[model samples]
Target: MSSFKPSMSEPKSPGSYCGVPAQRSSQWGPEMVLVKLEDCSHPLELNVIVKEEEEERGIKEEEEEERAFTEEQRAVTEEAEQRAFTEEQRAVTEEAKERAFTEEQRTFKEEAEERAFTEEQRAFTEEQRAFTEEQRAVTEEQRAFKEEAEERAFTAEQRAFTEEQRAFTEEAEERAFTEEQRAFTEEQRAFTEEAEERAFTEEAEERAFTEEQRAVTEEAEERAFTAEQRAFTEEQRAVTEEAEERAFTAEQRAFTEEQRAFTEEAEERAFSEEQRAFTEEQIAFTEEQRAFTEEAEERAFTAEQRAFIEEAEERAFTEEQRAFTEEQRAVTEEAEERAFTEEQRAFTEEAEERAFTEEQRAFTEEQRAFTEEAEERAFTEEQRAFTEEQRAFTEEQRAFTEEAEERAFTEEQRAVTEEAEERAFTAEQRAFTEEQRAFTEEAEERAFTEEQRAFTEEQRAFTEEAEERAFTAEQRAFTEEQRAFTAEL
Candidate 1:
């Protein structure tokens, strides 16, 4: 062989520490060759495989933690919903209590109105009775006055008759006893002259007495006539007074009825106004309750959605952390495999490097897929949670509106019923008033009939009296009746 020294351009040695081929070297030592050979066979490197396996385990644990966090989030959501339901129930209960109180108030007001109406009716009846009694008293006074007048007239007539009878008897006795019966005529001439003079004086006295008697009789007759005329005038006045009294009584009854009707109408209007106010209050309360319930439900929904979102975010964060960790582990694995490339003896490092690059690409692709899936899942869960919360809120609002409408309908029905009751009560009151008025009129008529019958009986007993006396008594009775009627008026 030609003394051959390996060229610097020759391929690198397999076991050289530097880039050189192996050579038989006596300058160093034979042991160095064995040591070098041993070193070459045993490759020492920073082992990264164990660390990669540990990183993978850590990633798995992180995923498990994320799952546990999601479970805890679900439990929290359930607790929130339960609390919201309890609050809603409490609001509903409070609204019901308010409605009951309003209803009780309405009932009390109606009862009070009815009591007042009854009191008014009682008062009216008492006034009517008082009026009737006053009429009776007036009639009695008139009758007493008439009877006294009639008695006085009768006595005067009797006295006049006696005086007339005595004058006739005295005239008859004088005429029967003649002047020739005189026994001793002292002087015929003197007796004749004295007798003549006495006769003339007697004649003059009789004429004067007759004139006085005529004047007395004329005066008595004129007094009786005047009395009869006064009685007639009193009778006419009494009749007019009675008519006026009746008219006044009728007017009073009419006015009372009108007032009662007005009162009833006013009461009905007040009742309606009260009912309307109550209905409005009830509606407001119901609406407020509905709004409160809806708000509570919305809050509950918002809370649940927030909890769900929080849980989702937590899960996403954990997944993102796991992906980051996995990426780091893959990069570390690739770096460690690259370091081993330089240590490998005679191995095709390019092939191994290519395989590692392919594995790294594969792992990167897997990590990308996992991250995308986690992001997509998180978005879907968020959308689903939001939709569910919206649906719950909408349902709550609808339920509240329906309940409010029903309450309003109930209130309207109550108002209608109250109005009907008021109308019926007014009608009853009017009917009762009419009946009382009729009773009063009937009583007055009975009193008048009794008075008339009494007068008739008295007249029958006084039939033997002079016509003038009877007329005077009748006139007096009539005048008394007029006075009573006028007093009543």
Candidate 2:
């Protein structure tokens, strides 16, 4: 064996096959070789030689042609695969968008449902408020009726006095009574105007509340519209509009019911009909909302999308909640105002009643005082008239007695005159009994009318003043006449 020669190292070109050099097997023909250089004794490793280059050039030309065909096939395959992958990714993205949109719609529907529920609760509360207002009106009416009854009873007691006194003071107090009537009318007018003002103010407040509700609704609608625009779907917008219409109708019904509560007359049929309609409509809306929610769950989405949508939904819910809270606050304030108004009205009415009572008491006192003074003056005049009448009657009786003694100087004539006197005395006694009955019927003998008392005094001065005064005066006149006659004899 030749002296051991050092084996040449393998090529270090960049091309490799299972860690083998590209310059491997240069002596072999243009074909793959299974040779291990380390197994060869004195392995001869060579660079790409001339024969190998020429053969390699020829083989490279063929490989280039084959490579071009293979490259064309592979490019076609890669393009097909890329197209398939792109289609699948696009399908996934569209599915994700659909899922996200469905989830957002579901969330929106849930929020809408919550708002509707809240609105329903508010409507119920408003209905209760209306009922309470109706109760308050009824209570007020009852109170007014009670007050009127009491006032009438008081008036009846005032009228229970003697008719004689009324006549005495009728003309004197007529203007005052008329003034009181006018004052009462004015008071009633003031009450009516106050009630009207309260109604007007309530209407204005309701209008303001309606405006606030409309503004809130408009804002909510704007948000919904914006959300619809974001969704870019016509179906969603229609549904949202339908929901808004339902909510708006419900609100309108609530307002109508509230106004209906103020009606003095109760119409139960119409109210029940409206309530039934509202209930049916609400049921339908709930069914529709539920259907919509069920339909929304048929898709899928990403966590980030869900998070964003949840945030938006939370914000909307927060806005609704805030509006509800504000509405509650407004309602509470209105209730307080109404309560205060009622209390003030009661106080005003009580004060007016007390003032009226005071005025009436003063009027009655003045009337009594004036009547007493008139009676005193009339009594004085009656005494003077009686004194003058008695003197004239005494002179006439003296002349009559002289004529009677001259004309009736016969026994038969005296007997006829005595019979006539007896009949006249009986008639006078009957007349006295009649007067006594009349006096008893009047039930106020001492407080008889001025005309009756004066007539009685004048008649008694001519005949008998309540019988007792005439009897005593006649007895004294007889005694004086007897004394005079006896002195003359």
List CA RMSD, all candidates.
81.7, 69.1
Task: Give TM per candidate.
Answer: 0.33, 0.23
Error of 1 at 48 (Å): 99
User: Candidate 2 on 1-489: residue-level lDDT in tens?
Assistant: 011123355634333334343344534544423222443333434322123335545765785587568657756865785576568557756865785586678568756865775576467547645754664475356446534653553354335332323542356455654665577568657756864675466456545644654574465446434533533443343345435534656468456435534531243354357447645754564465345433322221232255346446644654564455446445644764566577866677655665575477558757755764564466446535544654454355345433432332232234334434533543454455345445445535433554475566457545633464555466557666654753452
Collision pairs in model 1: 13-20, 13-21, 238-482
Evaluated with TM-score, which candidate comes out highest?
A: 1
> Candidate 1 lDDT (Cα, whole model)?
0.51
Which has the greatest lDDT?
Answer: 1
lDDT of 2: 0.49
